[model samples]
Target: MMDVWKRLLARWAGGSLGGGWGVVLAAGVGVFVPGPEAAAQIVNVQALFDEATAPMGFSGTADLSLDWRTGSTNLIATRLLASAQLRTPPHTVLVVARGEYNFARDELLVSRFLEHVRYRYRLLPWLAVEAFAQHELDAFRRLRARALVGAGPRFTLFSQEEASLVFGVALMGEYEQLRRDGEVDAGQERLDPRLSSYMLGRVKLAQNMSLVETLYVQPRLTSVRDLRILNETLLVVTPNARFTFSMGFIAAYDAEPPATVSRLDTQLRTSLGVKF
Candidate 1:
């Protein structure tokens, strides 16, 4: 009986002691030990992969609402759009970043740029036309001498959705001197073929979508140039009216080669577009 009592007391003591040690060990690990996979991480997954896209349209969003962010969609254009606010005697400048589509590329370049700043008369209520000659750079690359001249009428489509619809046509001549980087061509510059009579049709899509279709006839390759044309059908989405994320096909329909550049060919490009 004494032996049995001794055994019971010893077992109880051992169990309590064991539990105490376990509690201490667990506390130590929970307080001081590092996590399992700390060393392998190089870049912050949030920063590297977070969808904080750049701003698109030209006119800036108001300071307060600018804080909200979107997770799904992207900004494809940002521009400083100027519409007429003829409150005073003469309708004056209203600075708003208007989202717009790029010329040759179906992407939106910037919201509103000073295409040509000049003194002109605001002739009609919603219609204004002008002509100007300016040096044309790819606008994105501000390089390669391409001169653009002539102008067309810009009319306001004042619908319920805030003049969101605009249609215009422009006629311009282009001299395209296609040049490659020095490392690739080794300082050899060729007189790249020129494209004349570049025609443009600017079509307004949804609230944040606009489509610009450009048709340019290749100058030199009489057959390919005669037959060669580049048309990009683009879809632009405005996440919060400040930025745009764009993706689309370069050639919607390309004839077989003998001619270069195809139809619905992503061979040219497929990537993210951001405007700042």
Candidate 2:
């Protein structure tokens, strides 16, 4: 498929020297949108503890998503920390509308349109496949989409300690044709403000007992540019299925200045949640 695309581009445009085809292939695994499924309908909420210890600051996330899929289409509303979101996926066809609600100052942040659609097909008991494409959105206040595709598989591992471990690996590629409306000069083309490809994998040791490690790495035009290794553990207790408490810590490195937006320092966070 790669070769075919290359040849087609070469033949057209009078023997051009551009590998825009390669660029498209590079941005195929990082594009996706939220969906409303029966299994995911119930509000799922999570909270992370935040901390700071020299050269680092740690924090976790807290959010819940509501599912709406029936009749002629699908929709999802997710509320996290200081933000709320509304999404609409066109009746089985794949056009999505997204709006963000800001609570800190109480106002509408933005809204936009999205394209690209995909469905999943189970290949085996432990394997599944999903195909998607680059989604288009309207955002005059920020960077727009270029290209992205992310796909992978997940595995379930059980240990004698009654620990259920779930892990998955995915390859993501995205092209960021970022438009410089602010900050730097216009049409400056944020050099390498994109990651050609990225690797993502996570291991969940126990749901409420603790034990989780994740690896994330992506390049940018500014900020530190290197892979990051983070170690996190959570002590969680649930009074019931509807209410819970959690506290945790995180350590990160190889990701600071010139490659990211925040300082590369260890951090910590804590939070409480309730779902109905």
RMSD of each: 28.8, 14.2
Q: Candidate 2 — worst ten consecutive residues by lDDT sum?
A: 36-45
Which segments of candidate 1 are over 4 A away from where they belong?
Answer: 1-122, 132-144, 155-166, 176-230, 252-276
Model 1 C-alpha lDDT per residue in residues 49-153, reported as the tens digit of each score: 101121222222221111111111123333233322112222221222122333334643431122221111235655644332222222222223322233444
Candidate 2 wrong stretches, greater than 4 Å? 1-122, 129-148, 159-161, 177-209, 217-231, 252-265
TM-score of each: 0.33, 0.41
Top TM-score: which candidate number?
2
Q: Give the alpha-carbon lDDT of every model.
A: 0.28, 0.32
lDDT of 2: 0.32
Supply the global lDDT for candidate 1. Answer: 0.28
